[model samples]
Target: MLGLESLLFLIEVGTLIPLIKTNKIKYNVEEEGGCDDLDQGDNGWKIIHTDVFRFPPFKSLLCAVLGVGAQFLTLATAIIVMALLGMFNIHRHGAINSAAIVLYALTSCVSGYVSCSFYTQINGQRWVWNIILTSALFSAPLFLTWSVVNSVHWWSGSTQALPATTVLLLLGAWVLVGFPLTVIGGIVGKNRAGSFQAPCRTRNIARQIPPQPWYKHTFVHMAIGGFLPFSAISVELYYIFATVWGREHYTLYGILLCVFAILLSVGACISVALTYFLLSGEDYRWWWRSVLSTGSTGLFIFVYSVFYYRNRSSMSGLVQSSEFFGYSLLTALVFSLMLGSVSFWASLAFIRYIYRSLKMD
Candidate 1:
């Protein structure tokens, strides 16, 4: 299964890389901007320059969430790198899970720094409150998911149920380690954060968005955004699903690392491309759209997990199904956060680069 899965993921790499190359070449510009009055190259993404960085609605909250998402994204990559380097044997499930928990708890500082930094960039007023929300929104749901799954396992007399002492210790670890790091990171980020650099001055009032064609709609963008990146990792996803459900060991740390890197590249490219389209259409609400467009890969993954559970390997008990779906949801959420953040940051950078390159008269 792992062999087949590896082959598939590699195949996906071949398919997606070409597509990315084509898009990058097609969209590559050499400093050409036409006036909006004449409407020459105004049809391009540059037309909406003013509103592109108009501080998205709920800007503070979005930044906080993105900050945490970025943190997890980095943490995941670091963990995979460590595994590939033989810091810990990737074959050991217990080791991987333990490492992940410790890393996540300890890495909250990154979340705080990123979230608060962005928040500060947007000139958010309530720094402390914003940081609090960032930590809670990310950690609370995951903790609940874990608790639910553990309770289900405990009810079924499965050893997967973490003992009460261990659960308490996890809570203590979060409070002692995660929370403070987040606060410290938040403080440092806020103090050091610079203003968001927008190439063009944003307007106090927003421009009316024209009705978009069906292809430019959220559903269309979500489908393209989600599936393209998801396709890149679908084969590897099968192995991951199999290991989780089949209770098998995952030892492909090197392949896993490669897949992780490719996924990030694919995510960023797709995001920038899609954001360009949105901006060209004069739709300025791209902040969340960028996140959701790329994050929809998680939704696609969840859908595939349903297929995997139903058709692929078989472990058809209450505890098994519950654990599979529950953890899968968390997995999707994490992917949405991690990869989506990558996409957004890339899009943000691309937008800034392109806008700055233009000669605004």
Candidate 2:
């Protein structure tokens, strides 16, 4: 898997090199007194400079989603680092879950800071609603899933169901620790926020986006952008599934950490490449597209989970199936946010760098 990822990474980097060169050449031509007219058959990214930084619609929701993604990125890194340091027994699932819960509560401030700061930067007026949305982005869905799964377990009198007191304590932790920290962070973020600084000035009239090729469509982008990252982790995913559902034990935190890094790198590279393609087509709606493109990795993971459950595992019956699929869905959601954020940040950086280097007035 590592070898394949390394090869794929090299290929992605190779693909990006030419795009970067083309952008640089276009900028140089403009600087050298070449034609500046957009209609002169120069279909490069320079033509859409004015609209490149336009804030996408639903700015508040986008900010909240990005904020949650940042939080998950931090949480995953921290957990991996602690595991590498032998902070807890890898064989004990309960220990890991408890630690993750505590860390997530502590990390609530990160989500608040990111979401609120981004919202402010984008000129969002609904600060209160933005913060509320950020706080509930993942938690709400999780609660709903937990309720369904727990009810199933309760009806079956299974010991796997969490006790009512435990559920209350979890809620209490989020309400008291997580909520307060998020509010505090939101206050800080709002105060520290600055204006959105796009290198190119936007025009009063938005440019009409040309019809894109079939390959540049959102679904195609998702399929292409999601597949490489999913392939990078697919082999390791089986081992993880085996460890969790089967009797196997996994202690190679180091390898897992490496695969995790590769996953992020692949997601970022593919997103940047796709964003470049979209921009070359004079499409500036790259914000959500960049996210959804790579975020589709989660969809692939969920589909793989179905495959794993049907063929790879020996488990059976309603209790196990519901639990497996439910948690698998949550895992998919996490990956979507994590990789999606990485994709967005990467594309944003790429866009800014190219625009900033241009000879624009």
Candidate 3:
């Protein structure tokens, strides 16, 4: 994406440079012989230079490209190192699950960069909001869900069954390594692009460009783009819990399960992006939209947990509605938080790409 964004920036500049030269030549011709058109002479050149160089669009693009490249490099390096360091094999029994986490983490990095890029493209106004959105949208739900699941006995017992020493070490490592790396990525992504200057060139450009209709694209974007992966993760969570407890198979099929999950993920991405785009009228709304989408998912997950507890009477002991609901909420909360947080940062990077295309300066 960063590479693509950079290439797009070059294209925008290439388009602009010719216009700049043409305007300058026209102005020079009128100014040479006491022409009455000062507006067509030095003034035109001044305006052209201002638009071409002093514009936010150009500066923002530069920042976005550099920042995204930094983040992508960092995350890619971190994951490669993590895998090589035997993080993948740390849990012998949960090798498949662990590997999946690593894979998601890697993919999440891309998502984070893309989303951030897109949001930055729309509204480069609030960095603090961007930071908070990133944290809330991507990290908060996951953290809450994990904390809840670890406390509850309803899901897979792996988190609960782990020795206190191992859990502490794992948490510490995540805090020290995972959190820092993510923070670094966010900082670079946010700070890299300073601003975008919208070109009010002739209304001709705006008139020629058809307005992007919202409804036309929302469903497909949300379904295939966002929800598919979400479905995959949710399904995976279900299996992880079921398998850990050696529960009976209530699944319809294995391949279908994967399909559902991938669909869910794709849907979730589109849902967050489209919802925010509608609310703020700025693609950059991902900063907050990420939070909203994640929160919405959590709400649904919490509700589902309520249903699960009420219907699930086969568990070892009858858990009270309050506790059961709490467990269910935790399940959604953890996954939602994780997903929301991931999407938030990813959305920022994505926004940057959009901004780069628009030539904000």
* Index of the highest-TM-score prediction: 2
Q: TM-score for each prediction?
A: 0.86, 0.88, 0.42
The better candidate by lDDT, 1 or 3, is 1
**Cα deviation in Å at residue 236, candidate 1?**
1.0
Model 1: residues with Cα > 4 Å off, grouped in runs: 1-43
Top model number, lDDT: 2
Candidate number with the higher lDDT (2 or 3): 2
- Provide the overall lDDT of each model, using Cα atoms, as 2-decimal numbers: 0.83, 0.90, 0.44
Residue 39, model 2: lDDT of 33
lDDT of 2 at 59: 91
lDDT of 2 by residue, 1-361 (tens): 4798899999999999999997676545555542332332367787887778888999988988898999999999999899889998866877878889999999999999999998999889999999999999999999999999999999999999999999999999999999898888888999999988676677667889998889999999999999999999999999999987888878899999999999999999999999999999999999999999999999999999999999999889999999999999999999999899899999999998887766543
Q: Candidate 1 lDDT (Cα, whole model)?
A: 0.83
Residues 7-119 of candidate 3: C-alpha lDDT, one tens digit per residue: 99999999999999977765454322322222222221222221221223432333333333334334434544554555544234366446544443444344335435544
**Ranking by TM-score, best first?**
2, 1, 3
Question: Candidate 3: lDDT of 220?
Answer: 40
